[model samples]
Target: MASCTRKLYHVHGFDPRQHLEHYFSDKPDMVFEEDFLIFPIENLTKTFLEGHIRGDVLIDLSLGSMIHHLYAPSEFFKNIIILKVRDRCILELKRWLNTRTGAFEWGHATQLHINIEGKSAELQDKEGKVREAAQHVAKCDLDKQNIMDPVVLPPADCIISVFLLDCICKDQDDYVRYIRKFSELLKPGGHLILIGVINMTYFTVGKDKIHGFAYDQDLARKTVAAEGFVIDKCVTKKATGISDLVDHKGVLFIASHKEK
Candidate 1:
């Protein structure tokens, strides 16, 4: 199995370290440019935002490399917000959103944040309604998106669910749950910009082994549609150097919007 995995890596010219650094770099410009798979997402997002999604809320569930884009605001979203429900890093997001101390400026309409690692908590407003929470929180699983540590805001106009599926979902059923969580956050007709690795991605994130679900462009579209979303645009591109240390081939997804 290991040899087969290695063969697969060479067949695809996968280089894990480079791929990981491309998306995790602190500097946005430092993002990996060689990989064409991610470019389509950037292009598609820019294209969709040209004039169609002005003033819509953008909720980033996975704050990995995607966080870099938040620095450069796009025209599609009226507000760009982030949610980190992981126990250890939850404070990092909270501190980022707490602009009152001049630490970091959201510049957007509002910067809402929460950390639910220690408590069995749910986000409820004054009305006692179980507001929308982090839908992709994975725990004690080798392959899942762990965001359950915090319960953030309710559903909004848009939710940007990035490579989260690779981390939080293992099968189609798990995918359904994650998608439902994201869907609940949006009002009718809300928009969603989802990005995910289209193939199995397994790598050593530090000392822990993280496994990704085998994703493809077609499956992505089907999953999105199953969640009551209309596919507005879809893109797929080739990936390079993603099988060595962090074995992930590439990313592909569609921009879906719920109809009112």
Candidate 2:
């Protein structure tokens, strides 16, 4: 039986559409909308509303092709740069940004964001703002000194990474190493916003199960502090969705600023 068991798929082999459908679709049975979508947006909106996280350029390093978390940041930041690990993820994002055919629908997420902000703007207008703010989308490699390599990026005022580390990092050392890299991308006193699953070992994307770095809030807090970040806010939500797609105990959101 052990010999016949299939190995877990790598993060690079991710199918964007299938992953999106399983976790981000509009169907009633899908439970990730609350933990993955609404939770981050709400926390981000609140953090931005407090008026401390100011920046001209914001860098986003997230998993797959997610854009829901950018709606609020687009309103605050002048420029948004998205870095993806996989080519397919980059293509998927471009399809939506360019308004190409077969792009995944994000109207629900847009509406939710607008509703939370109590704004009366049209959904299309908000989406257009996101597209305009997101001026660049490029591929990145975590193993490199310069993640973008060849094309050096100016130090951003803020960086928002959602669920990417959990999917990519193999162990605590990898997590800390990547956190240091994230520090390198920011200017002094710049902010770092991270959203990830707590104590999650694995998550399913399509037919393949992918590894998730099993970590808790304490590790995240200590790691960030060790990397010269001053913790500003940390929030966690217990898993409410009764689904077996992922064995996540809960979701975590941390907002910190790099020390000068």
Candidate 3:
């Protein structure tokens, strides 16, 4: 039921409102009932407590409020790093995350947001608004096939590469490369927790091709396992229902680091 501000940014002759309504509307039903700080479903928090990880890094690709909303207070990791493609969705997501205008700042302010969505007027506009506030926002477009780039931040104990796989990739190779970069961003024995939509029929975000990556779940699982990650859990369940904003069948992968 969260209202999104992306409806106003649509290009001419493109009314993806209905399409997007189905896209943005559906969410994890547990989202509202579970407090991320103490949520049991989060494998990262559970792994951190099991003494499997210890370090100064928690890279959050596709930086959105959901992950932070769940893990920020836990401080399970020392430093949090965020990466995202520069699009209206991410920009809106960042705005919601950065709106800590209360009397106190609860979490550490060491988090960073790297803008990796290539160049476009809409993307430029989204970045322009957030550039001043996010000190570490980077200018790289994963859609342009630059997934092998080096990590912009230091190594971390865990990398919560959630919801980014569906956004940053246009094909299998790009998806593999992006996951490699995500792994490279972490130190060995670190963890990776990823969530993405699988078996999606189609996607369109205001005249933009935002959802045509042919999300091969089996191939993706094999690829991540090949990237020195141990497959702890891969859950593919039908969401209880569809959302009016966003539409797609989805899957989740919670991966841990392999001891080399």
Candidate 4:
């Protein structure tokens, strides 16, 4: 089991496209669509509808090259800054942002956002708004004092991190440390939206089996509180799909704010 488990950065076989398709694509039989795409989308839309998370800038530190989670936030925030850990993930996002040939089609995600909001908007227009709102994407190193070192970033009003900690953290302490780093990127009163897996030990990206820290909701709450965050809401959805690609028991979503 130890030999099979690989750290995220060391997994050179990680395929961004395959990763997206396996978990996020609009497939008829894909079980992950509900957990990875719909669950976050619905919860995020609900949070945004409550009018508590809007701001001038929102920083996203998500796993892979996913943009599905940003659809609702794009409408509420004036600017979105994305920080990616890998150059491949950055290039994958840029392909869609620049509307280059062979970019992964996200029309399905855009349509889902529209349908959930019960609003009248064309898919192309909604996609454009999300693209426009995403003003910057840069590589990040969580180990550094400044995650985006040499490129000083202003404190954002909100930060959304999806499934990143699970992939990067090797233990409970690492999770706590990363959460503290996340808080530092936000303004004192800013919000933090986290969507991650629960009791997940590993997940597959292409042929690589990357390590995931198995954590429960209690640990998440305690970690966030210990890092100076006040939890406003916490939601969990049990895994309804059976797949060998990932061993996650459920999905966890937390909406919290840094204590001022």
- By TM-score, the better pick of 2 and 3 is 2
Question: Which residue runs of candidate 4 sit more than 4 Å off their true CA positions?
Answer: 1-3, 9-13
Give the residue spans of candidate 3 off by over 4 A.
1-51, 63-74, 87-94, 97-152, 204-209, 243-247
Please provide the root mean square deviation of candidate 1 (C-alpha atoms, Å). 11.5
lDDT of each: 0.50, 0.88, 0.47, 0.88
RMSD each, Å = 11.5, 2.1, 11.0, 1.8
**Better candidate number, 1 or 4, judged by lDDT:** 4
Writing each residue's lDDT as its tens digit, candidate 4 over 1-260 gives 34476756424426788888888888887788778878898899888888878889899999888998998898899799999888898999899999999999888888888888888999988888889999799888889998877889999999999998888888898898999899989999999999999999988876678888899999999999889999999999998767999999999999999999
Ranking by TM-score: 4, 2, 1, 3
In candidate 4, how many clashes are counted? Answer: 0
lDDT of 1 by residue, 45-82 (tens): 36454556545456766633223333212334445555
Q: Candidate 2 at 95: error in angstroms?
A: 1.1
Task: Compose the digit string of candidate 2's lDDT tens values, residues 161-248.
Answer: 9988887888999899999999999999999999999998888776667778899999999999999999999999998765877899
In model 4, residue pairs whose N, Cα or C atoms come closer than 3 Å (at least 3 residues apart or on different chains), thus clashing, are none
Q: CA shift at 38, candidate 4, in angstroms?
A: 0.7
In model 3, the Cα lDDT at residue 73 comes to 16
| Candidate numbers sorted by lDDT from highest down | 4, 2, 1, 3
Q: What is the lDDT of candidate 1?
A: 0.50
Error of 1 at 57 (Å): 2.9
Question: In candidate 1, which residue ranges exceed 4 Å CA deviation?
Answer: 1-22, 26-31, 36-41, 63-66, 71-78, 91-154
- Alpha-carbon deviation at 72 in model 1, angstroms: 5.8
